[model samples]
Target chain A: MSASSRRGVDVGALVEQARDGSPRAVARLVSMVEDASPALREVAATLAPHTGHAYVVGLTGSPGVGKSTSTNALVGAVRARGLRVGVLAVDPSSPFSGGALLGDRVRMQEHATDAGVFIRSMASRGHLGGLSWGTPQAIRVLDGAGCDVILVETVGVGQAEIEIASLADTTIVLLAPGMGDGIQAAKAGILEIADVFVVNKADRDGAQSTVRDLQGMLGLGGRYADDAHWRPPIVKTVAARNEGVDDVLAAIDAHRAWLEKTGGLRSRRRERAAREVEAIAVAALRARIGDLRGGVALDSLADQILDGKLDPYAAADALLAETSD
Target chain B: MSASSRRGVDVGALVEQARDGSPRAVARLVSMVEDASPALREVAATLAPHTGHAYVVGLTGSPGVGKSTSTNALVGAVRARGLRVGVLAVDPSSPFSGGALLGDRVRMQEHATDAGVFIRSMASRGHLGGLSWGTPQAIRVLDGAGCDVILVETVGVGQAEIEIASLADTTIVLLAPGMGDGIQAAKAGILEIADVFVVNKADRDGAQSTVRDLQGMLGLGGRYADDAHWRPPIVKTVAARNEGVDDVLAAIDAHRAWLEKTGGLRSRRRERAAREVEAIAVAALRARIGDLRGGVALDSLADQILDGKLDPYAAADALLAETSD
Candidate 1:
């Protein structure tokens, strides 16, 4: 709606401006992505060459685990090192703010006018495939826009949070005392995905105990055993007071160094690329199938299943056959 | 691994026993489903004749909004009315007890040995497509069993919970007074999926205001406005005390009745079937892609992208082509 947005900058211009680290251009580019505009493919084609440079880190924990505060602290530290930072919080907890944008913005208001930081809150709208559907593309936009670092955050409560693991190079599973026991987290499958553990709210009473619980659980796994070169480290932080925040960053830096040294970085990025592509292809196929619904073919398929003449698996096979054409 | 479980009971026998309202048979069948056993297709085929009688209901809200207590109360009320109830909690929290099953069982202990109730807590392991991957199949097993009503409860904090709405005939969104404002819920996109809203913990000070706020927000939504048949009714309850719980059931029943009268029930179920089938097909395709990874074709494509000789879209196209064969 602004005069200096998409209306002012054409598709190529927008991508170019964005790659030059213009926050407004970046915002406009992502908004286009969120809208699923026709020109998005154009943006992607344009952004293709410039991506794969930024390092993506995911911050996840259950709600009230101080993810926002930690993200704020991380941004400050990363910015102090003079790196442009991009924050994408895939929040599903707000109506007006979309992904708790208002709350996140208020929590991260210190970076409000900082030219070195670009933050966008993706509302959980058009949530296809358990993410903002356009998130990977938006990450490309930010990465293509020349951000040195991008932090992807999600509520670490459900299956959707796993998307961040696939997207990020380094995943920090932030925790607060009394959130839950270690078994709860392991069973939740967070243990497998976490590269670094941040015990946020370290001033809280159970912080040491929480750290111990996590350590004891980690010991039970072969996670850092034998073939593992880099074990996930738990860094405690009172994010509210900004204490031990630098230690957390140092842990991340260490993890990054380990990744590069072990050649795990390339594998991770390659897998991320492959996964992203597969998701897109599946989404495309889904769209094709979705378009077929309400038509006679799909309705009759539904009818046959409802009539018990066809089971769901057979019906799905038939649908897949239709798609291959 | 049990003596009389899958190792002993053949698929046909399992199906027969499950249909005879055998709790052990149902549990075994569901476990087989959770394992994604090769006999699953046979099981689904065999049980196809007996499903569709159970009226599925979904209860969801953010974690700790009293969903468990409310679900327990609803089960008690429904069972008192002579309906055999089955409960499935798709919990992503906790390591050992998926969906706080231990706590859930403790709360609903009175119904434990009733023989009419079958309770299952699905761990959010093998999280394929924002669900436990076993949920839809497990529902089929439960539906095929003799339960007259099945309740699906999920921690309504992430994208996966939306799948519940598609799977159930009616979705009840549970909220506590301090959960946040109407904007948060709306932003979370829970507004669209909820067929009914239950404000649990009504004794809290802001309880009335929560109801009022929800009512005001509902007024803004055109969800049922054009249909004019059933607007989502907000029911207040202190589920722990079991008061006002029946009203929630009544609201669900009313929604169910309206759905039946309008032919909406059939449409909803039909859509659910279609969606489930599509999800299965997509998951299968994803598995195919996964299998092909590290193979020559996928590696070359990945290399092409990394080398900047080909873009991700093109790589994805090449990958999707490989899956069809």
Candidate 2:
């Protein structure tokens, strides 16, 4: 290991502890990586070889839509089916405190002490698209440690939250009644990415109407053929009362089975692997360019461009020319 | 012009006609670009030199949320101040019909014959985000044609719609009462980018409460001293009655003044220019790479990686080596 890696912390040892089933060690590792400690890359390289086991499920929706309650109920349902489940609830980072509430952890206390369950709450930390750089790495650690199902709950909506859909095998979009305007507004982003739609708080007055409206809209712009068989399904749940959780689980199972039957799961996994490689490569290239000798030239160029002394195209050309030499 | 540019319709001539105040020519130019015609890129290049004249304003919210009504009223307010206006109402493309309702055009018919007012509808055409690739170029055409203010209404609430915020000098996010769930869900993306917030249909039951909730949320976030002068102002509007339209316009003016006074506008413009250059460079690189002599070999490697026959990292390395040689 390099000096920076050594002096930072022994993340590999913590990974080993986590693999051997130490919750505290896993928690510590997650925190270290989320904070982008220098040792994260080392830990990630160590853990990469053991990943690809878990079926990651992403749940997203507007706030106050019962995402937490639904997640907790889903965990209970999954446990009853004899599956080892792990939950990663991403919370909004407090811009002031730079900390997260981890409220989902508190809300799901029923499974907190269960040896079969592991729960972690992550803060967004100003990461664009609501994902920290360490999220995929943390998921790898959990997957390597033998979690069968990993549930990821986003802190917010739109493109950032939708990114979870790209990372997860199955993505569920939660909605509530009286969100007609919001749903219409979000049609361009969240609605496009949903693998399944769940209308939570189904006991509300406009529950049936909301479902009908969504169904009508889906019909008008459906991307899948009725015969395609893995089309996104709509489910209704009153998560607070734990109603309709089984139906949601059944829908997930059906989707998984379809993925396997159609040989889509393998293809999806391959796509994900390729994407991960590309993301990492791009990030590494940017970092290396930042660390080059005379790299401060780029910063100075930015200042010049900001001050209108240089056009952006001319500055980019100059930067590229300098790098080429 | 190249053979490919000549064989197709001359986009520059069309643009010149549009600039000479021909509404039919402007409409046709938008259509040609939106359809991704072969000569679109060349046309965009020609139009680029004429951009940076108009102040682009983006208004976005959920469908069925009175966005059209608000936009129509805002156009009147802007024109009443003796400024020529152009409105681009972007709608989601239907997966089945490959068409859009163009509903906003009909709703804003009051200005159809005003000569100074131009309105057009754009379809999303499967672009993942809300804004289409041709939007900026279309805005440039309108700018060169002497529109004092260009208003872009996004297709939906997705992150693509939020892209308009980055492109426009000012962005207004419209929310209605009972959209608390949507607000909570989309807060992470929309709130961060909003220059002005509008709680439309404020006569609704939950309007006051929702505004209060938003205020509380904004308070909990850290305050930047630089933003103090241009803090996003929330205004209530009843578009049907034309109430609060003046306040919204005044708020936009105030924000623009603050942006200029604080030097935020110049810095933001610089960042945008840089990003645009980066986007163009990346696109050019992708196109050039596809036309290289060893392009087939690179493509085959990419296929192998996608099929999982070879690891993505190894394939990337091989491609990079081949290209360098």
Candidate 3:
């Protein structure tokens, strides 16, 4: 109940420290969220009252869209407004580079001395596939810690990047000129996810063409959108030069204001919470089932499949029956 | 049981017709698989003995890399060898296009009159996010239907596309010139999934550079490959003209040879089967839990979270406890 040893800091003390804007305490809480620690339930209980104050923004696009640069730029802009900011970069470390990407995102280091900014990267270290499971919970930690806004940046590649869209109140899909066919952008479902589209590296040739292509694709209705009735505005930016970053921020602010005015913000947040609840529940059940799989029952059911005795759905029913209680 | 009518198409009858190389019957069986019909388990049992006969190849790339053209070329090559082939193009119909891309994949129509080649497209319709649940089971139906080779082509976008890499005996990752930053290839986890790399539209400027860039990146060992120590071969193809198509096929053949020679094929297939089995099981349990959610129990638990009485993980545990039986 009191501030004790650093190693065994209790949930209440850690929450207090995090709420007081201690970066170390904030990092520790997020780490706990990532690990799905036993203390997570207690931590959630403590942070409950303080949650939902922070606005969440998800920035995603094809890798090389300068998502990190834009995210860094946005953090700087937000911090300038005197609002505390948290940035979660999912898998910022490239396994192919042996983590050399750590040095490439120099703009992040430029703000290392700014206590007003908190930046963290959720790398896919040992995660073989899918986004990290702890992301939603970690966002909660940031929100509950009293940040004014949290920016989640993912290298808009892979299937998991879509998670960012569902979790964020506003989603910014970034693109770069000459980066590939505009059709690929539509194929990736980016058209459906963009609340705001940023054509980064606007100085590059074909930037206007890219914007036109995106707009043309958006005009089509086969795609999904958070607001089917609201048209997404495309903003051009030279993110590397920190040019037009403020306009992107302004678009976000405008969208947020509209959402609140229309009461869409509250509903979106509720849906987000519902999704989080469902995902957590399913993951837990999967773990329990995984534990059962270590025994002979699952194998036996699978053996029945090999023997052509039972169908997969029926066999799954049997497995669930055995493990449910 | 006899196939008296469409409604009464027995699993046994469909399997028999499909095994006899009837494309109509094969398509029907796949549809059942996709629908997750109650007969799925029964169908799996029926197909189990005849399955594993076809060599499965997965071709994936960011959309607009001429995947369909390349696939059409592969089918022609395989048919030239007098072997029957199956092609599954995942998301060939864009949700935004209302399946207009189905018409756009005109190269597929070139093989329309070829009895030895069967081509079908799976659209992304209402799949929440991630790969559709039914893809693997559909593959089983094709394999059991006596196709000598089956090609699974997915627009290299979204989380589900990774499923193609996992399911295929050999995975060919396609890329084109000017498709964005070369470094993004590494970050997207694409580098790790490719068994063979194909730089399509090889006549375009930067085609060679893309190849050089890919080779340079692959030179980096921070990747996971089917053969941990084996290097992936790169092939260049002007697929639109059908030039170098044979060379690309040669690379596939070469990779297949290496896999078979090293017993990598057997292990890869086993892993594929394991994943398929796990996915079906998980999907079934997800369905069961989804049904439970239709009742009040889940809502009450959610209410507890809103009231600050329970954490998500704890509530999930309680939900599992009540439903395990």
Candidate 4:
């Protein structure tokens, strides 16, 4: 039987269409990844050869820091350079939460008509392996679709933000003048991940101070250990007015160059792939353990722990043995 | 040899001392949990029989919503009722972040000298199974220490907060006036998890409107579809002044009573124990996967996936087989 016939989804055809620049096919592939479909293995195998082509840029900050506006502007700038761009806005809000962040995507309506630009918003909640698994799978879909650049925008919550940083080739940490994001950026461990820092809403008061604050903190953090190391640059932007966006683009390009020059890009992608593999493996193990709930294994183990006859670690050891078997 | 001689930690002595209300022993046991020490299995086994005695009350909300204040007030209320209380302030902030929340624990210091009260702050970052594994282990420590009530206070970040809700017998969601927390609550999926809601800073403007907004939303959500259902009661409090804290305590008591009357308490505990067991197992499985990174199996699989020669799911299958072996 043909590979397509073996699976519910015609993975081979869909992947071929996605590579031929069909947005519908790309969207369907991404949806399948998001849903964690049974045919995901087939989809991934089909798309594997076409990925590693897209440059992923991650933008993250607290809510209302103009992530959508900045992403929209970046898409325009990247497209001006005659490159296909994909925008993946990872909404940190719960799925049940009203789509406030998703609603913000209306600003990207200008790019809706451009065939070169694909915009999609993912609710970063309730995924099988959490956001880490679903996000990279979606990125692979876009990359397979021949995108030159993929921009990932996420609300800067603590752990989720860190996970996104690991996925991107370049990470831009956004801040606003009056948002007290300087302190928050430090608190959220954004300084360590930011390849480029964009101080959005620079037209407002305290913009210079915010920039200075970042520079001072960066110096104190000793982020630059040597002259050979690439130091993150701070770019001021008025994204709402589409101002200073070119500078942000330049910063991104500069970082990409440093990465390519140092062979950091290859190493980073290697590390990311390792994490992706590990995450999938862990999720699969967890699912197997979950499947055992239907049997007497997990419930009985839990009962033993609950009744104080066995500790959790011992029960876990029993579970591991059973699942491994 | 005794079990204590087999491990680095004298688990039996520690558990015995903690059961005798030795604060140092309780602190040591909790520290072991937080650190995920090698002796943790022994500790859990020792503490198991002593658990399932303390009632877990989770207090969570956005930063600056007075979680610490409300927690402090509730501790006092519980103390007034002659109950031994354990306050576990689970700091959801990154450990690298300045200890801003750790500073918040200063407010809980009045109970510092009280032998009946044990307050500990845990950074909810970098634990093995995220916060799920560590928090409950710490709760077990406190429960074994003879706490009648254990309060788990966490910042209402997305996933972490939901995990905390599951750990608690009663989850109290705190919101301050003018924080627009009503919309945030629904967005964070707190409405479904909240066993009781507290509108803190009731003296502030918009307190009544906040209450009304919550009531309207709760009514619309139909949380009380049947008469037997426990509709989460809204208690207004100026936690700073200790005003209305008694009412909050009463609300908690009422929820506990309802849980017991409906046999929900036993089921919830059973479910929590199951989750605890599962989390431990998952963490153990992940650790095994992590260990494989030192071998050629994981790195080679990652290299293949990075080169686009293999898909992640296929790689994961290989990893599971290797780990199982």
Candidate 5:
């Protein structure tokens, strides 16, 4: 297809195909949404009525913590429960090559041919946060595609990964043992968002000690109000060996149950929807600003500041003055 | 001082004291400015004439990766060269306590009584990018204080830490050996910005392998047309023992020399200043929007979105209607 034609994808036909269980259509729709095409937004207006079904589980961690392996194992476990699964592995685009390596696909080879499973990788494309603006919209596409569960594996680049906490209903923070003070650092921003902590690579020597240290750091609970129905649980797992995957699945089920009973799940979904809309609005504003010769003016102001002809404050004032109120 | 009184500091007196080589004045100025008060910005305007002498170096890494130790050792190294040093360590506010722990003070105790070195710690205070909006103004305070070099130590929370890269002349990304997979993950966002890479904890078993991996991943010896005059070098260090710090200083000096020769440093500094101004302007707009009850309308629109009474697109359109030209 021509690039313009691809960009101007027929949203209704794609949605129909996705609803009728065409994986190619689902992938195309995901691409369209992730690109934040205006056409895709129109499609989302139609698909929004069909969403709110899939139980989204976000998987995130410091890179090399085996999140993909854990996600693969979780997919298997969820499949064993007779539910369809959709996986969205968010990775950074190579600055040299705009294409994502789709590293998660290699690890998730087992699900490649499984009709009940769908896997897609989203690239950052140097977006402000690690997630693209269209991520929530893409998630809705997966939701409308009849997937019982959707797993979002985040780019484990720290604070940006925390945005996933706001996006997912259940967020699992994966960690490996013996990372030499990494656990303490991880606790700085990501710890609070974790609905479940999976100490992956449990076969490693310091796995038990890592768990003990984390439990000690967490300090006997009640940090958050107890009224939420479920407390975050730390589960030990050897993802490569497929051990403890069942426990992780059980923990997810328990959290989902609590979310349903306490109405927290609905509230979280509502917040996510709100955030998605705000993000889209902000992105549109940025793009509009860019097209209004803002980039050229910004560069010239930057040069003037460098030349000492203009101080930053005055330059900012001038830029703001140019913006129509 | 009462917190508000502390906020209402005398910038002129502080600038005069700083010019006369008073560390206390510099410290108070940084403290006043780091709070991001309008008063601080006013102070900055008065001090702007006396600023632009100090070379700013931003040091960042994941928390517990020994950024403080490295920064302390760096201060020592810079002082040995007879240049006065100023350190600003940015720490995230404790969610539970709402007070900063000021951990850099504990780590850099050797310089506590030094008349030549001024150290201050800043709290992130929920700033989105791990930097308060007033940080550049604080740097101006230190600059006007006659410090030869100012080192900014970031909160080390990954993505938020990237903000430091924009503000500093030379940015160093610290990693430790045996953080294998974590290194790959960090490479996804941060490794590209490293003007210098220090492999801390080089005493570990996989230190050499880690260095080799980094060298391979970075593809050294490949010449690019846009290459900065000084190529970033990977240095090994054991921060606790203060090993290889001199080499880091030498690398920084070399980078500085190259920056000056190529006029890259001046341009980079100007770019940073321009960016700071733009950020402030954006923040002002956002604050104004909030003050006008724009957020209330947005929130109500969000509620309508959750109730399915209004679609996100329409809600966004409605929210921007007043602002749209």
Candidate 6:
């Protein structure tokens, strides 16, 4: 017990190292979280006091919408201000996709040698809710490591991305010209979640109309029914050339200011924490149910349902009762 | 006690009508399941005895892969064989997609007036796991409605589609020429779950190369290392023209035969039922956790985590204990 070999590390020392800006310690902590290691409990306990400082900004859009490029540019801009940054590229795990999008990582090569910037790509191990269950924990690791800002980039087309949006202090929804993204954005309900909108590849055709279309849709959304509301601002950039990235930074800072001024930061963080706690609780319960599979309980219930002797809801009730026992 | 008004539905009568071929009744049952109405327990019970007769085939691909058109063509082919068909368009619900893909439904208009066909569109309603929690219940509804074959169509790019694939007896993964879908398919991990592959838009220039790319990948996958292994066969079709659809149907039939001969059908259905039951149980548990939000227990735990007094896992453990109590 005194040795605590299961964790295989001095968690207190690791947390101290992270707080003092050791990128290796930060990466190791994040890997522990990402892998859902048993050591996570101790790590999180150690990390608690060191968190609550980093601002999490989420960037998401369609696959070809320059999200990675924009994120790269944002990292450069953030680093220019002498602030440390962390990037978590949360790729929705495909049972077959096998790994993270390597192409997207290539764009971040510019920051590979910068100790002040930490970049990690995570793929869901097909855990209960894909990456959602583990993502918040990873963010906490970066926060504990003293990143001034953390950027979470994910493809914005699924429920997981929506969950990521709720976890963010500010969310940037990127669109590019000629992707039919304006209509697609509206169709995908991306508009409602955006704290900031970026039209990347601004040099491309129809960039202006893309912006106008977003403006038209926003006008129709009634998102700003009063002065207290924050209407998402749209910025255009050719992210490949690092054009207009500072404007993106400005938009983020402005949103952050609004969040702080309105007490939105505290409330949003509280909501994020609530959801994170709920997700963990649910995942743990799910694992208990999975444990039932080793016994005959779940199989028996499934057989009953298949045999038409019981309804699923009743079977589920019985299973839950067994779980409680 | 004799009248259960909460359901606003006579579960027994509804199930009876659904079994007797009333599309309206089937639609109502599906709606109950989709809406997660209080009556669902009774509905599932009543429908349980009447299901296990439908062969569920899942169709999935990226948005532009002509999934709806292919589904429409297959419906025609099946209808021509004089078998009743059910189509469940399980659209992954976007918070703001507003509704199902209306354009996809337009292609199915050819079967709208046919009594032998039943089609319904569903969005996730943002339930615990999105559409997944409700989908199997809805499929049971269709099976009880006397459909001989059920086609579940979904966009194949996300975790939800992967879940849909697991529910299927025979899963058909669709692709089109010029979409760079070969690489996308590999990247998305669509290759692993498919029992059948359809290369639509065969007249397009890149179609043959697409087929070759798929064959090459499949060979590299070592999916058929033994005689007992089932290799997914690729079928090319001009679905809009109703060309080569029969071959697609042939591939489906062959797979179905193989599944039945090897007792794979029973095991697959059992797995599907297990997952369905698990999803429902988890959703119930999640909802219970949500219910805690109405009290101070969850919020208090969340506050402690935010204040760095407790880690999320410990909070989750406390929350679970409270739930059990």
> What local lDDT does model 3 show for residue B93?
38
Say which prediction, candidate 2 or candidate 6, comes out ahead on DockQ: 6
Candidate 3 residue runs with Cα over 4 Å from true position: A1-31, A42-277, A288-325, B1-9, B36-41, B62-64, B96-101, B125-129, B158-161, B175-189, B201-228, B236-243, B303-311
For residues B1-325, write the lDDT of model 2, one tens digit per residue.
8754468677677778877788998887777657656565555555655666688888887766688899989999999999989988766544321244345557888888888898887765553233434566567668867789999887445665567777788999888889663465345477777788888999999989878876765666653436454567889999988999999999999888888888877666655554443443333333334454234665565456444355444544454344333
Q: For every model in order, what is the iRMS?
A: 2.6, 6.3, 3.6, 2.5, 4.4, 2.3
Best by DockQ: 4
Residues A130-192, model 3: lDDT tens digits: 443567778878988888999988777766567778889999988899987487777887777
Cα deviation of B14, candidate 6, in Å: 1.5
Error of 1 at B66 (Å): 4.7
Enumerate residue pairs that collide in model 5: none
TM for every model, in the order presented, reads: 0.61, 0.54, 0.59, 0.69, 0.58, 0.67
Q: After superposition, how far is residue A187 of candidate 6 from its true place, in Å?
A: 13
- Please write out the lDDT profile of model 2 over residues A265-295, one tens digit for every residue: 7666655554444444434433434554234
Counting clashing residue pairs in each candidate, in order, gives 9, 11, 7, 0, 0, 1
Clash count, candidate 4: 0
- Per-residue C-alpha lDDT of model 6 across residues B161-223, encoded as one tens digit per residue: 678777899999999999999998898788888899999999999999999999999999888
Listing every candidate in turn, what is its Cα RMSD in Å to the true structure after a full C-alpha superposition? 9.0, 10.4, 9.9, 7.0, 9.6, 7.5
Ranking by DockQ: 4, 6, 1, 3, 5, 2
User: Over the stretch A1-325, how does candidate 4's per-residue lDDT look in tens digits?
Assistant: 6655576567888888888878898888878776778788888888888888899999989988888889999999999999999988886655632365457557888888899998887766554544688888889889988999999988888687888888999999999998888899888888989989999999999999999999999999777733368789999999989899999999988898888888889888888888888888877878788899878887787777667788888888888778876
Q: What are the per-model DockQ values?
A: 0.28, 0.09, 0.19, 0.43, 0.18, 0.41
- Candidate 4 stretches greater than 4 Å from native: A1-8, A59-83, A93-116, A126-131, A153-164, A172-227, A232-254, B1-8, B16-23, B47-132, B139-266, B289-297, B322-325
Provide the TM-score of chain A alone for each candidate, in the order shown: 0.85, 0.83, 0.83, 0.89, 0.83, 0.87
Model 1, global lDDT: 0.80
On residues B196-288, what C-alpha lDDT tens digit does candidate 4 reach at each position? 999999999999999999999999987782336889999999999999999998998889988988888877887787788888888777777
Expressed as tens digits, the lDDT of each residue in A186-293 for candidate 5 is 555666778888899989999998888777656654454366445578899999999999999889888888888888888788777766666665555555445534
Fnat of candidate 6 is: 0.73
